[model samples]
Target chain A: MSDAAAQVGLPPVTPEEDHKVSEGKGRAFLGIPVVGWMLIFFGVPYFLLFLQSLWEPTAFGVAHNWTLENYKLVFLGDTLSGNIYIPTLLRSLKVGAMVTICATLLAFPIAYLLAFKISNSRTRLMLYVLVIVPLWASYLLRAYAWKVILGQNGLLGSVLDQLGLENTFLNNLLYSQTAVVITMTHIFTPFMILTIYAVLERLPPSLIEASKDLGVGRMKTFLTLVVPLSLPGVIAGATFTMGLSSGDFVAPQLVGGKNDVMIANQVYSQFGATNNWPLGSAIAFVLLGFVAILVALSTQAEKREQL
Target chain B: MINAESGLTGAPTAGAPAGHAAAVELDNVTKRYGDVMAVEDLDLRVEDGQFLTLLGPSGCGKTTTLRLIGGFEAPNRGEIRIAGDDMSSRPAYKRPVNTVFQQYALFPHLSVSQNVGYGLRHAGVSRSDTAQRVAAMMELMQIPDVGERRPRELSGGQQQRVALARALVMEPKVLLLDEPLGALDYKLRKEMQFELKRIHREVGVTFIYVTHDQEEAMTMSDRIVVMSNGHIEQDASPAEIFDRPLTAFVADFIGDTNIVHGTVTRIDNGHATVDVGPLGEIGGSTDDDLKSGDRVRVSIRPTDVRVEAGAAGEAVVQDSVLVGGHIAMKIASGDETVVAHVARGSSYEPGANVHLHVDSDRIRVFAAAEGA
Candidate 1:
């Protein structure tokens, strides 16, 4: 109990009581603006999209008559195109997983070096800025820059041609699924590095030394001790990339081939050329559902490890 | 002047038998951080199963020497041998030695048993055997019920024991502890000191402990190496360190004492007569190759100086400080002052004349050296 509480002849506030008071009075009302903002900007639009998905699309405009025809077309497949929605959504997931794996693999070493290996603060600061400076450039420009490099006569091809290795490196290098993965991995790596670096920076250095002192070799110590301790950060970084890349439309549009189109591309086409807002909103919500489930699972896993 | 090698005495413990093999040896080791020399031309040896302590103030190079032995830091010019094998080029991971860090660096993510069994897992011990040994080690540390608890959930004392258990479970040939009790409160520090000494006796490993606490060193160490300014000032048993300090620095650092400045008037067989300006002539033991007219300081433990009330004495009682079991009174004669530790409840008021008697056999005379 606090001295003030004792002097006032009142009981000290327990955590449960404090929580109850916060939930009971003006403090609870403080959340009104944030909840209202989310509802007006997000909740109402999502509800309207759900309603629109049930309405039928007429030639001139959306009909007021409610039906499941749009959902049926999305699930059973378009009459002419067989099962493109499932395959496209699955491809998006695969791309998100691939990008997340590659980014995390490439980020751990850089984060470890930044946090522990570099002894000088000034040098570490310079390297930190180097990692983040790429994010300062326009994302569209960076994506386009990769497009130029991966194209047939771009940097890799021209360099290979100059070396007389003409057709060796050209096949499927440009406008392919691999191209999308590569570009997205490059763009998402800094986020992973920063997250992992933040965790590593706070880790006590003596813990590593203690492991080594107890007859554990360097490599084993890293695998057993360092990796498990840093798993939360790795999960956090993977969550960011997974959430962002699964719904990404820009990278695939600029660098992907015909068969490499993701679900976001289909949704974009429905809203633009097809003028089918109902179908587009349905696809968007489905993708959002998958990403939301993954994020929740990862965060829950992180919390479990905290104990 | 005080010299490094002259103050060293033989190991006084009964555990180290004659011809006992050295578990660790450092020959003229030197370590430098940039241009600053953290340890300089240091040579030391530890007997197998001996509990040795490095006692010094902060920045006294004691920690650097421990690191040198643990292979955490390589010496610029030296040869280190562990169990008669040269370990100068070996890294910390390959060396058969372990260290309990100052912060008790237990793995926060692992349970107490997992932390204790970590090194065993690396060695490919069977799961059952690992569990058995971890349980036994935890039992030895008196923390049998904390195996499933994470380090963050344990008390400071429990965490320290867990760290000890973690390192000892590896069964290393030597254990290095860097101020392991420094983070605990006074009462806990004292308790852990006894706990560490018990563990040392039970395990019979060569334990190299470091601390700046003189009382801790005196209580727990079989031998203590006192360091100052990147050099070994005195290396001997704690009793000798307190009773027969070879230099003024050793005497002043180890415990409370009254130092009276004087110069050697004559030397007779191992005993020297010195003339203190205000207290007149006094005779004490000397070992600094003293000659006539050589400046020196006579060190007397406060308990050795007897105070008697008198009106025609050379000294007068200045004040009496009440320490629980004893009263430490200051006696001033002209410009010289000396403290006498008397029994509690002695009522010697200020301004009372007191005749001071010096225990000549217990007094230590060292040459007054500059920058010691």
Candidate 2:
């Protein structure tokens, strides 16, 4: 063969072809392992759940019917001993919204302090440790501990009584939506602080100094510069708190009375006490739908901000 | 007595409008961080509309001096004045100056226009006027298309221009640029130097630039302050600082020079005769307070040492290396070694025993005590 024909037979000469070959090799190396892992772990479980959602329970076992009855019952609500779950769904959303707001508000100042004010690395580490230490304790134990604290003659009530504030404590202390919101806020506050603090820590100090040099007062700089820059962390914290609080059954069960029992409690009751797997799964699907919609909205908002 | 005429004179153009008055003055300013003094007794006067550079080696307190003037840090002692007002206790936000940091420090989340409009917005300028000003500033920077682009989307040079536009939009009396071109590559940095000079001229604001690179300082500044060890070694126009360095440190720091130690044997008029051992007698002018028989170090710039074959003048060439545009030759007498720059394409070889003629007028004399 001539030289040109020989070269052409060996490989294509274009830069694009060279790029494609390398890219193909790279994709094969990285893509196969990740897709495999996702399929085995996440995709398979989600597929099974999807299939189960469409299945109807029979005397022998469950079988696929692919009916919309379960979804309808979940959304429209069905009479369960003449009581419906709509109120519980609303209560769960209310508790989630309150927890998100409370945690975000409480986290901002602590995160600001950790990121901007605290300079010593050891002290920051210590503060982070303190924030995460509560997670080391059993979640059930923490819920039960709140039960002791919020009870009629618990530590808080005793303190109030000792301080001669028994009337105020008794009137608004426990077993209400406020109590549930407050407990959930406390439980999820660390997540908010940590997420916000992580974002704030990555912010360059020069940006703040530049603002100051540009005649921006301290408060204005914080509002205009620091706050907007940390929106990602705020979103992350809010989504996490909302997801956790909406699906939580433990805290409400331990400290919450009838009015504060969230949708998760109803699902648990349907599955365990009422022995209604289909209804429980339906409620779970509803919760999952709500979370997915919220997460999708947040992701869209994040994408817009990034662009 | 300090000459008031020289101190307060405006630019030379007669019909041209006088720019704003002096914006910043550092009077014997000293800053100490623990045992290390970052700036020691710095006295600098920044003329309005003039670009002054604090040129020095690293750790020579140029940045510290810029920070002190910008109100980012207060001097341990001495007074700083801005617009003839004492700013010793003023915070950065209270100062009538803005700084363009070395890293540009543009808000990564903010668009170019938003970043430039920040100071105006904070100053409570009307929305329409702020928008107009931001647009005009972006146009002036030749980056109108970058108004909506975030900092990360822009190149380093674009980011630098945005930083400048941001600071300039504030209309601060003084603009402090701390190594503003340090992050850019050589070619871009050279381009930005001219751009910065033009911007300074057009905006008519006093600029206090800090850089360790001597060439950048020399190229852009109306006056350069060469500093060493937190002290101002020499403060003069670029030509004067380069040509007439008052100290040995200034001589060595600014450019290549050959220094030789000797003892003064005689003084006549503006010239001093020194006994430089193997080189026999050398003549130079004294910048130091040297008496007869006192040891001194004489400095001659490499460009001032002329090498000629077949005529012994003062020193002999021991070695030579051709470094394009000029031949760098090592000439020595006794234990003292000095380098001379011979013209390129010169017919000179290593150990050729060429005579070195020191330009008497260009030679600088310094007291041996101030060697550094």
Candidate 3:
């Protein structure tokens, strides 16, 4: 609509047409390397994994003959074990749900305080650095550190003993599902806080003022205004936490007790100790299916809120 | 020459309706954010249904004063009352005042109807009653068709109307608008001005508008409070403000006027004869407290200016624009400048030689201001 460009003898392009021009023809070569890399490294592997899920596993090793027996085992369960595949996968989901809820509960308050309450920019930045600082170290180290802290002779039990509280209860903290949940929650909370804070930071202050101006009280305003506005961020964070935690094997291996075996650990053992790649790939698809549905539903919810 | 136009001849509008009270009052209220004193010991009273505008440049505390009234910000000192009730300790939601923010902060996630109905929900109104009120308010704003659209989908002007509708739907005791038309194009702003005035009349709610646009202030306000450096310089009708500014800041800010520094040489009643340095002696008028020996500044409106290609003057015609009904000329020499609104037929080239002339009696002298 501006005449300046036309007056300057330049062709005026609508934003839509301009985007098309940038994306089409000669510019297509610009994305070739990244696209080619994704197809080679990502696309080919996932395609091969899909094929591996359908192949036969003989007594010696994986054979060329294709069969649906591995998929049947994924549904029918391993007769040698007490339905461990389906049960472990379901347990993984429950843990993922637990980690997601706990993480979001802890993250929202921190995000809100940072975005709205802390007016000092330097202070907020310092706190944000503190939150993400742990991500710099190895993820395994953090998970392993939790095992040490939660152990009977370690930090928690020793602290309890120092405080003269019951120390025996601390022994139950490590090497359990609770340990897995607690460690994963601690590890995943920063991502949730970052995502929620990004959206909450962009919330226009005027909107809150306007809501209050209209006679909506502070709590009501937060529920009706702040919560809805931050839903996309919450959904995004929840999706990541759910997807990663449900498929996670490392935390379960390091912190999980004998009964806390998860689907990802089984997926690993099928390839390593068991030497049954076909069953592992088939089991992996079940996890993929659940995570895929969660992601797609969250994305739809996010898109529905957009203008 | 003018001094309060003698009696401020721009007769004040009819006093508030009988039995009507002030809808909002700020008594010696001061608001400070960190080191900046945004509003200082300010007292203001907006009468019921009065269209009062706080007109000033940015950082003049006009918007801050509006926010205090709307309870968006509590004062650092002093009390604010709405409908004769003290509102000092109350938060924005507890007060009976609403604000249409300068940016028109409509709820982007909600549809137009939902946005309008949001505040009503807290009123504990029935669903049908909320619906009826929301529909009526939307109809009043002329935005009924956009009920299902989100805030971003609407045009700027439409969003402004929706904001107004959302606030007014609450039937708050006072409505504060922080330059509601600031983001609109000039043509749309002019149109929205009339729309706003019409809405104000129909609703009969007190409107406290804030804007730095003097023309907008002049065209819309029943009373305009001119502010400078967080203090009020003048609070009067638009005509009085335009004709009889009390300070050099007010005169300079309100119109296209040339301020010429001078010293009073003689006084007759409230009128004075001043020595305008290079411009020589000129007869003008000012407040009686400005004694004959006091330094002064005189204001000459552009309409009072006349230029012709005759004797050599201090300034040459710098530029001229044909502004519909008149030719606006910028004439300058050294640090001194003058703007003259000439007849439509008058034409002057950028570098044309000219002499500026003004009727000596038409200049208005003001007492010199301090560092403020």
Candidate 4:
């Protein structure tokens, strides 16, 4: 046999066929599990949600009628015009953006401390436990605690009343967007800290020392080396905070007023009070789409940062 | 010309020869971590453009000494000076020195060119100048193609070269290399030793290298400062250190040495006749100050002792080993065993009572009390 034929274990003229066989098997090995899981969970649920959004609500439970009316009703602002759906959606996006920024900013210093400042393993572990312990508590309980703290007759009001500043505090602080943001930030801050901490921990200490040895100051080292290297964590934390805050219905419901209602609360309202299941499903899908877009953008940003 | 300063107290003048300027001076430098003293009373000087290696085993404060010089840690006492200027209060960034760490410590996230350009960028050099300097450094290190590759993407040797380039591009007066070739394999490390020596010469910067490997220290350094227990045991050229170690620690550390304990029986001229327990009276040069009855350890390098067939003289061969480049034989006189090395093709068998002759000039005598 010729060298080419022997090398490929095929006749010279049939190389393309051999290549196809190997490529097909290789792709099949990689694609089967991912495609199977996606079809079973994500693909099926999304398909059902699409069907639900198209179905019209009738006197007998819900009925299937392929129409754009439900989507039109959501967009037109004529159905429950004065209600909180559109405003809540906008508020949720704003809250998500705010939480993302806050979490990222707060996480950087804590992560830097854990990764570089604390050298002893036991001390680092203890600090890590302290940061993570809040996460073990019930999310609802934490949100409820925030409500108590911000309520008119609660912690803030009591403190302000003692200081003779109760009037100003009550008017601005309780049941507001600010209150919702503060609560969400508390709940999600650990997630951001832990994610960023993990990435920072893997960073080689030598790089920082090398930076210093090269006559780069501490602040410059953080800007040039620490921040750029730990960006994946920042992106991950941002995506997580955005996803959680935008989809969160409970925290805002407890601490937020009618004006503070987010898109999740709107979806809940559409499903429960209005009994508009199709509109609710459409709104939920829209939120999912929005999150998917954000996730994609963040992933693209991460890749660009890597380059 | 040598600085004509009178005593040790006199400051080494500024216009002293390039090799006598004391580019780096550590006077009574000490470092303590809690109760443990990592470095104790380290007094060292690196003349301008000298390649000085801090040689020691692990945890011997060689790395700590490098850190002190780099201004990474403050000494508990004394002071550090770079070119006669005190730098005790200066942080690592402000010091005019850079270290190439053992692991190369190349920034994994950055391309080679970016890492090399980092110091220049921090120095506020123009972007174009930084790029030009980085390219020049890459060319100097002979790794121009590796500039675009991330550290992990390159081989061990490639990463090493990039690290050297990165530190050298800064044009620091002193370059501290903390076991820089420790991560490379034997052959590669040997190659890098030569490359580093060449680079040090070409750059004309004082290179303070740290390594536990004695062979590497011997090959690359203009002078080797042998350290043990955070104290300088002996500081000399590799040849002097190997051929004339002042302490048993330096004798044992530098290379293979057969140390036989003996007591001086007689003193004549510069030669001392020693009576080793099993070995009969042997005469070796007394390079140290010793009394007639002073106990001493006689250090003989394997290469200096000669083995012969049958009893040509008064030595008895106990065992013979044929290592590739040379034949190593263990010879004994009574109860004392001495290791001897012969040329590769020598046919010598164990149990043959052979004569052992040593080059008297190559043997070193040290006080047994100083053995570590």
Interface RMSD of each: 1.0, 1.2, 0.9, 1.6
TM-scores for chain B, listed for all candidates: 0.92, 0.89, 0.89, 0.90
DockQ of candidates 1 onward, in order? 0.58, 0.56, 0.71, 0.51
Better of 2 and 3 by DockQ: 3
What fraction of native interface contacts does model 2 preserve? 0.84
Enumerate residue pairs that collide in model 2: none
Candidate 4 lDDT score at position B256: 92
Residue range B159-223, candidate 2, lDDT tens digits: 99999999999888889999999999999999999998888767778888999988999899888
lDDT of 4 by residue, A61-115 (tens): 5787888876666665664454445566777899999987887888789988998
For model 1, residues B170-211, the per-residue Cα lDDT tens digits are 898889999999999999999999999899889888889999
Candidate 2: misplaced stretches above 4 Å? A1-43, A58-66, A79-87, B1-21, B275-280, B309-324, B327-337, B347-353, B370-372
Residue pair clashes in candidate 1: none
Question: Could you tell me the lDDT of residue A128 within candidate 4?
Answer: 94
Once fitted onto the true fold, the runs of candidate 4 whose alpha carbons sit more than 4 angstroms away are: A1-51, A65-88, A120-122, A165-169, A304-307, B1-21, B311-322, B330-337, B349-355
Better of 2 and 4 by lDDT: 4
Computed on C-alpha atoms, the DockQ of candidate 2 is 0.56
The runs of at least 3 residues in candidate 1 whose Cα sits more than 4 Å from the true structure, single-residue gaps closed, are: A1-82, B1-20, B258-283, B291-295, B305-324, B327-341, B347-361
Tens digits of lDDT, candidate 3, B67-135: 888887889998887887888778888888888998999998999888999888778988899999999
lDDT of each: 0.87, 0.82, 0.86, 0.83
- Candidate 4, residue A199: Cα displacement in angstroms equals 1.7
